[model samples]
Target: MRIVILCGGESSERDVSLASGGAVARALLERGHEVVLVDPAAETPVLAGPLHFGDVVDEFAVGKEPPSGLGRRLLQERMEGALTAGPVLGLLRDADLVFLALHGGWGEDGRLQERLREEGIRFTGADSTACTAAWHKGRGQAALGAAGLPVAERAQWQPGIEGVPQAVRLLLAAGPVVTKPVADGSSVSVHRVDSLAELERVAAETGSGGVELLVEPYLPGREFTVAVVGDRALPVVEIELSSPLFDYTAKYQTEGVSEVCPARIPADFASRLQELALRAHEALGFGAHAYSRTDFRCDAAGEPMCLEVNALPGLTATSLLPLAASGAGWTYGELIERIVDLAMS
Candidate 1:
């Protein structure tokens, strides 16, 4: 099968996406599939020749901050122009499957998926509608809540909106609040605020940049994630954060976090987590053979509450989906192969 892996977009997760794309390309190549890696945001989109794992590993040596200002503007311009470029579209149309290794921005937010669908190209994971619903944290939480899934109490705030601070103050009255971009991945710009002053500072700083934010009561229990591939939920993986929040550095840098696969919890609890994960996936309209990863955190009562569903979960070395897959007795190559098979089916 000929597969074109899309990675490294104009989003904050560009480096992480490159790492995922490289790792995926290598796995698919080892499985005897024709793999081509394309960074849609690049000046020359197609990444020719075989991928070297060493080079790929270096791509994600990301700093604590995301790309900004001039660099980001240039990349956005290139991404907008490159997607419709003849070479890029030709590769997409020619491939048997276009595996999305992208994480945030337009790539994972449904815009790119919609374009591909309009061009009559097949891609892995959920369709544009599902992606759109899942990409927005508030929207996804609403859908999950409507489906009777437990979700943390949350309030939404856009930049420059009046009375948002008051609402956030009300939410924070419950306890320390977690704030993050309403639509983002890799935990970019995520922060935990325990004081009104700090919350004000965070809101002011974040809002000044025109980013929408969601504030929710901070869950004080264990953190876990479940990945659903096709119709099956893989084993649960527990996250142990070295910091108060699972920010960008903690996610990509190995030392800041530890993940325990098949999380060492009671069998019933794990089963419940898996069930909720699958239910959340379905509630978001993900069809058969679609894949997603649902994140959770236990509340003060130790009951699990849904955080958000990753429409296109990362496949990087430290990514939870592959770790959960490993716990389910699937090798890295086998996991990639399974995803390809599901997409082609």
Candidate 2:
């Protein structure tokens, strides 16, 4: 198959997306599939590092350049262009399939998917409608919770300029709440606020301008993520962070953090999580999501608290999904193959 791997975007997650593209490119080639890596605008990409997840690829990352050499350069050149899909959807005209690794904003939040739909292109993962539903943290929470799934107590702000006041009030109500760009992955702009003062500060700091905020009751539980490929959950992973929380730094900082697969938690918790993950994916009308990572916080009673899901989950070598896939006995190449198959099928 001729595969076009798209990454790098105008969003804050550009670096993370490129790293995912690198791993995807190598994995596709190893599986004997022809590969072309392109950025969100569909331009050729170049990075000077090991290209793994969380290596401080640039200033945006921590403060280090990933180990570099032949591997980095080779991955950089495997693609025809490194531009984002925003401008390069034209370039994908003749490709067999588009495998999107772009995370956050327009890339993952359904903008690009809508464009692909208009162009009548074949791509991996869910469509624009499903993409939008899954990315909107508050909406996903509502849908799942209504379906009898366990979700943290939460509220959503309305859309439009008038939405600002409603947003602040909601934030205040969900106090000791965690604020984030509701549609983003990798937890960008994610933070905990304990007082109205801090909550107001964060409300002003939010990107996407008056975009709805997902304010959920701060629950106490272990954060575990379930990575689902197609309709199946790969495995469960428990996140252990050395920091106060698994913010962007811990997510991409790769220094001392570790992930325990088939998490140490009891089997019942894992089963419930996997069940809810599939239910959430289905609820979104995600006909063919190639990769899905459902993040949750399990309370002291082992009750799984549903968080948002990542439809086009990261592909960096050390991402949660890859870690779970490894435990499932699927090599990097195998994982890529499974994703591409679902995406193009």
- Choose the strongest candidate by TM-score: 1
Q: How well is each residue in 1-345 modelled by candidate 2, as lDDT tens digits?
A: 776777765556667887887777777666666666665332344233222323322222322322222243343333213333333545566678887877776667787788777878888888888888888888878887887778876666433444445545664674567777667677776777787777666777663455566776665667888888887876789998775466776787688477899788778867877888888778777765556788888656867788877878777766888889998998887888887888766
The list of candidate 2 runs beyond 4 A from truth reads 42-87, 157-175
Q: So what's the TM-score on candidate 1? A: 0.95
Q: After superposition, how far is residue 295 of candidate 2 from its true place, in Å?
A: 0.7
Q: lDDT of each prediction vs. the true structure? A: 0.87, 0.70
> In candidate 1, where is summed lDDT lowest over 10 consecutive residues?
49-58
Per-residue error (Å), model 2, residue 174: 7.8
Clashing residue pairs, backbone N/CA/C < 3 A, model 1: none
| TM-score, prediction 2 | 0.82
